[model samples]
Target: MDVAGAPRRFTGQYYEQGRDIFTDVDQNTFKAVGEEPVSTFSIDVDTASYGFVRASLNRNVLPTPDAVRTEEMVNYFRYKYPAPASREQPFSTTVNVFPSPWTEGRKLVRVGIKGYELPSASLPRANLVFLIDTSGSMNAPNKLPLVKQSMLMLLGRLDADDHVAIVTYAGNAGTALPPTPVREKARIAAVIETLGAGGSTAGAEGIRQAYELAAQNLDPDGVNRVILATDGDFNVGITNSEELKGYVEREREKGVLLSVLGFGMGNYNDALMQTLAQNGNGNAAYIDTINEARKTLLDEATSTLFPIAKDVKIQVEFNPATVAEYRLIGYETRMLKREDFENDKVDAGDVGSGQAVTALYEIVPVGGPRAFGERRYGTRITEAARGNDTEYGFVKIRYKRLDSPTSRLLSTPIDRTKEVASFDSAPRDARFATAVASFAELLRGGRYTGSMTYDDVLKILGKTRGDDAFGYRSEFDQLVRRAKTASSMARLGS
Candidate 1:
């Protein structure tokens, strides 16, 4: 245990700050469009980073730069993009380019993808295993109790066709409730309410048992998932990340997906949870409040439970004649090698029903200020090779159906025709998403957010705050105010 008196796994070293376990990779750097014209990365739908940042700001502390993944922050909110017309494609992509709000002479390109939405009555039956961590570390109100309430919210959304099981891990792993139909809500709630937190965390053991239960009660034509709710402190058994990941990988091959629901703040192993969820071909979400829980499990139940596309990847080829330098705004960790984009065996991110994923890129058009210094020697595009003045880049997406081995391809050309004259003239969703991305960059040290301040972000957000049906945008406004106050306090302390 650290100074906070919270129970933590006995790792090699004991840091006084128990929250030191949170980990993230370095950010992406600008790439010259002349040298590397193609940008490829897997689509990510995880919303944990945004929730984690919100949790930190709510506590009056600034989140670490690593904790702020700008892409995840932007994708957390639902955008009003049109869904695909048919399940044959599963998703539709929309691209828009507008003047960059942060950089003076550059342009911001937004790529949006919306997965097909299935009616609630049309959703397939589900076999869900709740892997709850009842270790001593989860003794707080924000951990075990919150998890119970969140599970209850999910239970309310499930129907008679769904089957539920509960497994808890402490010093040992055991089944709290056997595979029971959703119609037995009273019995399920009873089992959940009886759960109490204590003992060490055998997360790996719990996972193995949950997978066994999930496989035993598998739904051949429906969703089979293990939802692990924990603070991500795994110890007592199979503590090595590689070993745990290997176990998850093997289980995922049997058609049992895994999604992680993170709770608590101190000692949260975000990196491990992300790795497990990614390897298991599922999504990860951080549950900070009951409202967030409802948003994840109830409001977005179809998307949260039913995946429409798997291993989705986007590769954009920028025309060197139109753009001189480019950099993907976020998704540093989701970057894929050019070769991996064509390799179907390579695992990527998944898109669920009605889920919308977005990616942004900052580009310096030819004759504009280059992100990096000019290349001493490079092949120049001639007038003929430059193609027409209307085209900007080609966007290609590859994804495999949930049950297919081969991947299908979709392509579209982004052109000057789609470019809006100014940021203010852009679509409301695009403008608001850009503001969110800018705010995220500001929170992550603002190295690239030139001349952009908190007030500037607030103003942009205020203008673009459309009809927020669920009040998510309003919550974002409150977070911005909190961040402003937090920044002021930090400056004073410094």
Candidate 2:
């Protein structure tokens, strides 16, 4: 124990509705127990409200085949915005990696970019319906009220040519405003402001009404979407999970995208929001503050409204000889089946135009013959005498055009014999990603093979801070200090 009276250890975790309980064991390990163990989870290193988890695992306790995907892990790294190649341009790639807090000599990888390729936002006509949940649960200061304010902000940003509608749900769903041109800003603001919170949550009915409004106002060449803002609490109608997923999936086929912006806390359903966004061919974001709303709706406006690639999947094959044992840092839930890479129907992440996605792998150099300590040498019997002349496997990416189902493939070779050390030759984005990953591990309980710590992670990140254009690097350093202090406090608590 060092300072703040918290335990310095990773014992285990037990999570339930609205609360997470962690037990301290040693400084290195933890286990989750309560309300079932969630596996697929997304965390915000900056804002703490929008954490997502899908803990569905089989009896074997390993992540399901469809649950693990490389892109999910890489996309999960959210540090350093991709720089625009030029002030006039919109997309640039940035990569960063920092030392792992749990694993010695290993690093966390981050790849990101600011995408300039704003899809043609010039939709001939856009029919946007807002599905809002105004239940009593959303009475908090940051709940429905903030949502309304945010919508108003978006309304202010709309063009006169765009069409907008509003649908609200409490015990039942109903449309408060019909489709109208952006010229009627006053009327739209009036309708939005009049929305009040009451009754129990009826998310399904709201979804139905929003989709109906969208389908009725389908824009042949414009953007037709149902933007659902809720805390994902469904008590009245259409509560069945699979049924809702199917409904949203079918609606997506109509060329109407779904964008889910989750608001509020307490009983927040990250799983439900994720499912809705994934199946609806859209993205999910939790709005904890007004700044987040501005970032999502205003700053990254084009990408949020238009997509460049859909169903993006990444596949990386490692040479058995070059890497002894490897594990993905985060995205423990988005792992993919090896064959699923070629399957087009498999749902994957979407990449906005000019968006830079990055992933990293901790590998052991084959040429150096590093000390692996024979962890799995005798665990499995030898199969048909595989040769040792293997080289680095290929890294492949698959993505479909925003409006098409067919996909395109991009592949790059990973030279096995080259044995590049990540610490020395890592790109800028890689270094950033590494720092983010390390920071995440340190924040959560990281029990890794590398024996990395928060102090080490900060050192690595500081060296490759890059241009610090958006102050993200400065923010990162602050987070590092906070984490270090928290760890010390936890130690003291123990």
TM-score of each: 0.95, 0.75
Query: Can you write out model 2's per-residue Cα lDDT over 405-456, one digit (the tens) per residue?
Result: 8877655445433333556475555655666655554444554535667777
lDDT of 1 by residue, 188-236 (tens): 9999999999999889899999999999998899999999999988867
How well does candidate 2 score on lDDT at residue 252?
A: 87
Per-model lDDT? 0.88, 0.58
Please identify model 2 stretches exceeding 4 Å from their true place. Answer: 1-15, 19-116, 119-125, 367-391, 416-425, 484-494
- Candidate 1, residue 375: Cα displacement in angstroms equals 2.4
